[model samples]
Target: MKLLGIDLGSREVKVVVMENQEVSQQFKVSTMSFYRDYCNFTGKIVVDLKKLGVEDADIKISTGYGKNNTDLEEFETINELKAHVYGVFYQTELKNFVLLDVGGQDVKVVRVEKGLITDLELNEKCAASCGRYLENMAEVLEVPLTELAEYSQDPVELNSTCAVFSESELIGQIAEGAKLERLCAGVNYSMYKRLDPLLTKFKGKRLVISGGVAQNKAIRDYLKQDYEEVISLAEPQFNGAIGCCYYGQLTGEAENRE
Candidate 1:
């Protein structure tokens, strides 16, 4: 059986398909383009699976930022937190760990014990702690995001608490002739600083990071100071969508058993 999962993220839409409980295909599209080209408004925005190019799934599940608010036709909606947790469970097969999912617009830190969620913290109010901050910093530096994520030592000090102001501060550092590596490290470290407070209470030996920021090596390096093990998902960005697919497969199997 084919299971389809769609994660309607703030910046992009992630799509994943699982065939016989294994990932068969995965891709992402800009949210704007996805809504414009692959969806039609029938009083409410309705996703056209044909236009999405994956219409042959036996089951479909939806998650992410728009899951709660967007009413999708011919799809079942799941909470973003639940989907993320399930995705980690499926990918890592670990029952106890701290899950940190930093998205384009927000951050989610969940504490899972014995495969169940015990506590979770969210940082939806600040862009400084999210993936968008790193994107903007990379843009200001005229560097690729991947390159920007490679620096983790001797970071320059960026004191701004706001995401917008931090960009201006980064430009000032450039004018001061700061080393490129230091500037990059500064941006990455600044993000870690913002995340530190949210993570202070969730004490765990292992941390499973998901979402776009999981690819940031510099931030991951900083995170190593707090946890003994910091593991990144193989498909970090597609985790939510993958979780939806896994959830569908699990539920489908249970129904068949019954």
Candidate 2:
């Protein structure tokens, strides 16, 4: 059967096509480009699935920040955290794990045990703990995002909790001749510290991460300290959409892929 999942995120839109219980194709597009060119805002903005290389799906699902605003009458809508948990479970056999999704504007932590969601935490009130903070820090350090994620073991202790002040602090560190790597590491570590409260709530032996920041090596390595291991999907950014597809199949609403 074929299932199509679309995640209408803040910065980007992620789409996944699943056939025979496997991800057949996946892609992402900038949210602005999608809305300006593809979305048809008659009553609600209708996403053009065909433009996303999807057509004639047996079942379709939508999720993320913009899910509620979509004009997909036939597509089912799922909560972001629920979709994230389902996606993680579908990609692995693990029944117990702490899921952390660090996106552009928010961070989400979900605790799942024995195929059920037990507890979850979200940090939407601050950008300091999210991917955007890292991006700004990287810009301030004059290094690529990949390079900035390289140093986390030993950090310079960025004390400011506000995203704007943190950037100013990083610039001050630069003027004071702190090593570039150290400054970058400080940014990474600071984000980890901001996430401490959420991580403390969901205690588990395993941690699974997804979303934009899942590719960060420094953050992933630091996260290992709290859990025995930290895991991520092959397509971490598309996990939520993929989970939506998995949910469609489980509900017996999907038919053969044609």
Candidate 3:
């Protein structure tokens, strides 16, 4: 049976198709493109699965920021927290760990024990610790996002607490002739500082970093200093979508057996 999982995030929409417990296809689209071009928003934003080359999927599951706003018919909607935990469990065999998901708009720090979420900390109101902050900072520095990960060798001290204020501070650093590498490190460290408080609460031995920020090598390195084992999934950003497919298959299989 084929199952489809969709994670409608604030900045991006991730889709994953699974066939018999294995990932068959995956795609990602910017949230703007999705809403502007594909979404039909009379009552709720409905995505045309057929247009995406997905038809007759045995089960469809949705999660993330825009899940409730979607009008996808005959679909199951799951909470973001549940979907994240399931994603980690489905992808990795390790049951006890901490899951850190830094998306465009929010940062989620979750503790998973015995294949379930034990505790969680969510920072949805602030952009300082999220992927959008990094994107903005990279733009100000005139550097590509991918290159920013490698530019930071030694992190400088950045005192700003707000994302907007931090931009001004970074500008001043640029004016003062600070090395680009140090500036990049400082930006990464600044984000880490914002995340530290929430992460401290659910400090576990094993850490699983997911979402867009999971691709940042500097952040992963910083996290490894605190965590005994810091692991990154092959497809960190799509873990939630993958989890949705896994869940769909599990429930669909059970129903079929019944």
Candidate 4:
């Protein structure tokens, strides 16, 4: 069986296709570009599977921020949280864990037990804790994000109360003769501080992290101090869409038995 999963995020759209339960093709496009170039005159999105070079699939599933905007009736829509849960479980095989996804503009924490979602917490109103914050801080520090990561362990205190004002505060610290390394470290630590509140309420030994920010080793290392293990999927950025495909496969099997 062939399955196509689409995760329509705010900034990007991730596509993953599985042929007979194996990942055959995975690709993505900028969300704005996809809409501008792919949407037709009638306001319908025309995804070009041939352009992605994947054969037609038996099933297609959609999830994430922009899922509801698609006009396709054939696509099955799944909740983002459910997709995250299945994605993490499919990759790690851990039934009980806390999943923390720090995306470009959102933070999601989900508690999973025995393959079921038990409770969840989400932060969308704040941009300070998300990936965008890191990007902005990197720009302020005039350092590559990768280079700035090296300073995470430095003892630097950053104002974490507000996302916008934090930029000015960083500049002020520089004027006060703070080492650039310390300033960079401060940014990384501040990101961690903002995340602490969102994470402290949930207790779990295993932490499965997803989304773009999952690749930050410093952030992951900081989080590791509190968890038994901090794990990330091989395809962290594509976790949600991968989970959508995995869920589609499971649902197909269930239907076949009935």
Candidate 5:
């Protein structure tokens, strides 16, 4: 059976297709383009599967920030936490771990024990601890995001608590003749510092990181100091969508057995 999963994220839409419980295809589209070109708003935004190029599926599932706002015809909706947890389970096959999914505008830290969520923490009130902060800092530094993520040593201190003010502070550091690498490292380190408090409450040796920020090497390096193992998903950004597919497969199998 073919399973389809879509994650309507804040910045991008992640689509994943699975056959016989294994990933077959995965892709992403910008959130703006997805909404403007492939969706029609009639009280809720209706999605076009043909335009999305994944028209064949036995089951369809969706989860993310925009799941509630989008009308996915015949598609079942699941909460972000459940989707992410399932994604982590599918990707890492680890039953116990700490999951950290930092998205464009928010952060989620979930504690999973024996394949079930025990506790979770969310930081939606600030962009300072999210992916947007790194994007903005990269722009200010006139460097690629990948390049900015390479620095993890001797980071300059960025003392701003707000995302907007942090940009101003980063500019000030640049003017002060600080090394380019240090500035970039500072941005990554600061984000980790912000995340540290939220993670302090959760005790786990292994941390499974997903979402867009999972690609940031500097941030991952920083996290290594705290955890015994930090696992990065092969398809970090596509995790939620993959989780949906996994859920579909699980439900399908259960129904068949019943």
Candidate 6:
């Protein structure tokens, strides 16, 4: 069976095609471009699958930021947490693990025990510990987002509880002639600090990091100190979509057996 999964995030739209529970193809595009060019915003967002080069999919599922409003017919919608957990399990061999998904506008910490989510936490009130904060900081530092994770080796001291104030603090560090690498490390550390509190209540030996920020090496390195093993998905950004595909496959197989 061929399945199409779509994860419409605040910043990007991730799509994946799976054949017999294995990934066949995947693509990602900035949400702004997707909205402006491909989507028709008539009450609900609609995309032409053929225009997007996806056709004749046996099953279609959507999740993430705008899943509720996606105008795709004969589609199933799953919650982000379920999608993320399934994505992690499908991609890795680890059955017991914690899932950390830091998206453009929110962060989710999920504890998986015996292949099911037992506990979870979410920070939707602020973007401080999310990917958007890191993007803003990288812009202030005049560095590429891809390079920001590599710039931090030894993070200096930065104590800003708010994302808005952290920018000012970063400016002060720059004026103090702090090494760029150290400042970048400070940024990465600050994000980790924000995440640590939310994850403290959960106890999982392994961690599966997903989302755009999972691509950051510094964040992954810091996460390793706390987790027995820190695993990053092959396509961190596509985890949600992949999870949807997994869900589709599971149900499709069940129906066939029935």
Per-model TM-score versus the true fold: 0.97, 0.94, 0.96, 0.93, 0.97, 0.94
Mind giving the per-residue lDDT tens digits that candidate 3 earns over 1-258? 999998889889899999978899999998888777776755656777777777789889988885466446566888888878788878997789899999899988888888777788998898988999999999999999898887557777788889999999999999999999999999998988898998987765889999988999988888888888999988999998998988888888889899
Q: Kindly list the per-residue Cα lDDT of model 2 for residues 67-88, writing each as its tens digit.
A: 4565465678888987888898
Ranking by TM-score: 1, 5, 3, 6, 2, 4
Candidate 6 lDDT, tens digit per residue, 192-253? Answer: 88889988886447788899889999988888888788888998899999999998999898
User: CA lDDT, every prediction?
Assistant: 0.92, 0.84, 0.86, 0.83, 0.90, 0.87
Tell how far residue 144 is off in model 6, in angstroms.
1.6
Q: Please report the candidate that would top TM-score against the real structure.
A: 1
lDDT of 1 at 216: 94
Pick the lDDT winner: 1
Q: Which candidate would rank higher by lDDT, 2 or 6?
A: 6
Candidate 3 residues lying further than 4 Å off, grouped into runs, are: none
Clashes of each: 0, 0, 0, 0, 0, 0
Question: Residue 171, candidate 1: how far off, in angstroms?
Answer: 1.4
Report the Cα lDDT for candidate 1: 0.92
Q: CA lDDT of 7 in candidate 5? A: 90
- Lowest lDDT block of 10, candidate 2: 249-258
Candidate 4: residue pairs that collide: none
Candidate 4 per-residue C-alpha lDDT over 77-166 given as tens digits, one digit per residue, 9 for 90 to 100 = 898898888888778878999999988788999998888888888998989998889889888888888887776667467765898999
**Tens-digit lDDT track for model 1 on 68-130?**
435678889999998999999889999999999999998999999998999999989989999
Q: Candidate 2 lDDT (Cα, whole model)?
A: 0.84
TM-score of 2: 0.94
The better-scoring model by TM-score among 4 and 6 is 6
User: Is 4 or 5 the stronger prediction by TM-score?
Assistant: 5
